[model samples]
Target: MSRTVAWTPEATETFDIIVELIETKWGFASAQKFVRTANQTILTLASHPEMFVTVKGQTIRRAFITKQTSLFYEITEQQIILLYFWDNRQEPIL
Candidate 1:
């Protein structure tokens, strides 16, 4: 069965911040594209939670939504819980 996906408060906040930053630095169109891409990626994760590589020695897995943005999530038996949206240009959080 396909697992559901859930976003934590931190994930939601960071996602909004990243979208706003994209709109400011790029354009509204780019921001929209990012949203669509993120949605598609989330759908993919629902069915294939292990598609992305897990963080070494960690339970979290990371998926690159774009060249500049990545998503961190943890897979559970019933759901994939989103942890954060990270800016790849910045220092690694994990």
Candidate 2:
């Protein structure tokens, strides 16, 4: 069975920040596209939780696509919480 996914408040806040940043740097359409790609990536994780590796005993995963930003997330028993989005041009914080 597929695992359920729920966003933490922190995840929601990060999503909002990403949307705002995309809108500011690109456009509304680009922000919408990012949201669509993010949702698809999260669902992919839910369907294949094993694809993620553990970090400090937590299941932390990243989705990377060339010419696009990467998404960081953590998987728990009850939820897939997004941590942050990192532009490919910058280094990730962890």
Candidate 3:
């Protein structure tokens, strides 16, 4: 069964920041493209919560939206909880 996907406040905030950075660095078209890709990835996660490999020794799974950006989430019984978006070049917080 497909599970629901819920975003944490941190996830929402990070997503906005990522879009803004993309828009500033690239353009509106690029930002829109990224948004579409992120939404599609989330939809895929809804049906396949474990599609991405989990963080070593942790329950959090990371899905790559782009080479530079990734979505982190945790799978629960009824849903996938989005934690935050990480810039892959930066040292991972988790």
Query: In order, how many clashes per candidate?
Result: 0, 0, 0
What value does the lDDT take at residue 20 in candidate 3?
98
Query: Tens digit of lDDT per residue, candidate 1, span 1-94?
Result: 7998999999999999999999999999999999999999999999999999999879999999999999999999999999999999999878
Candidate 2 regions with alpha-carbon error over 4 angstroms: 52-58, 65-68, 88-90
Poorly placed runs, candidate 1 (over 4 Å):
none
Candidate 3 yields a Cα-based lDDT of 0.96
Candidate 2 residue-wise lDDT at 65: 29
Tens-digit per-residue lDDT, 1-94, candidate 3:
9999899999999999999999999999999999999999999999989899989969999999999999999999999999999889899888
Q: For model 1, what is the error of residue 4's alpha carbon versus the real structure, in angstroms, after optimal superposition?
A: 1.1
Off by over 4 Å in 3: none
Q: Candidate 2 or 3, higher lDDT?
A: 3
Pairwise TM-score winner, candidates 1 and 2: 1
Measured with C-alpha atoms, the lDDT of residue 69 in candidate 2 is 75
Q: What does the lDDT come to for candidate 1? A: 0.95
Worst 10 residues of 2 by lDDT: 58-67
The models' CA-based lDDT, in order, is: 0.95, 0.72, 0.96
